[model samples]
Target: MNRKNGITVCIIAIIAVVLIYAQSGISFGDPVYQDMDQYFLLNGQVQTGGNNICTDVVFDFRAFDTLGEATVLFTAVMGVIVIFRRLMKGEEYEAE
Candidate 1:
């Protein structure tokens, strides 16, 4: 198919998927305070021993998950920088 038709099909598919996802009601992240209980059970308390359950869950039990999430954010930023750099380099090469 031509470029325009391919782009139109992709956009339609993306919109359909997004609509389905929105209707599914599945949530990401801490939905409620009770969600912390599972984390507490899996990971033992240390510095979070006497702290509130939610705090313990957030700072202690899910520490690595949080760290990985932060790493992902950092990676995305770096990726954006690399992408922009490549674009700029291409422009410079074209200019030269």
Candidate 2:
């Protein structure tokens, strides 16, 4: 095989091995990490001012995660807008 084909095959084999090892550690259809869930369910309302457990967990306990997701989304949107901005700003065509 050519160098490129050999390299591609090696890379794919490596990725497959890594994925197999990673999947072996996870217990699908089973609650492996229930302590955190139990703690949140028991204390979410008490720790947060909101009486609603779901709201408290999302808005208070996991607010930083939500904020990070929002920030990433905003950044991606801004990047797309920036890339397409020149066309909208009357720079779609120019005379040589």
Candidate 3:
């Protein structure tokens, strides 16, 4: 194969590997017993230290996790900006 074909194959292979890895997720089996109220109080009130379970889960117990997720979004936005700048080169727009 020619050099162009080789580079194309390499790029395709890299993309396939990335997609495969990105789609993989954790799978937890069903629990033997279910207790809704107890589970809610334990995970929500005790762990999160908040009066409201829902609020605790979202802001208190998962505050650090939310921050981490925001960082990932920020990183993705920066990556897109970098890629766009490279693709546009001298033709990039300038804001006043």
**TM-scores of all predicted structures:** 0.39, 0.55, 0.42
lDDT of each: 0.73, 0.84, 0.77
Estimate the Cα RMSD of every predicted model relative to the unseen true structure. Answer: 9.5, 5.9, 9.5
lDDT of 2: 0.84
Q: Candidate 1: what lDDT?
A: 0.73
lDDT tens per residue, model 3, 46-86: 66677888777667756898889889999999899777876
lDDT of 2 by residue, 1-96 (tens): 999999999999999999999999888878877998789888877788677887787778889988998899999998997787776866653434
Task: Choose 1 or 2, whichever is better by TM-score.
Answer: 2
lDDT of 3: 0.77
Instruction: Tell me which of candidates 1 and 2 scores higher on lDDT.
Output: 2
Model 1: residues >4 Å from true position, as ranges?
A: 1-52, 86-96
lDDT of 3 at 11: 100
- lDDT at 56 for candidate 1? 69
TM-score of the candidate numbered 1? 0.39
Model 3 lowest lDDT segment of ten? 23-32
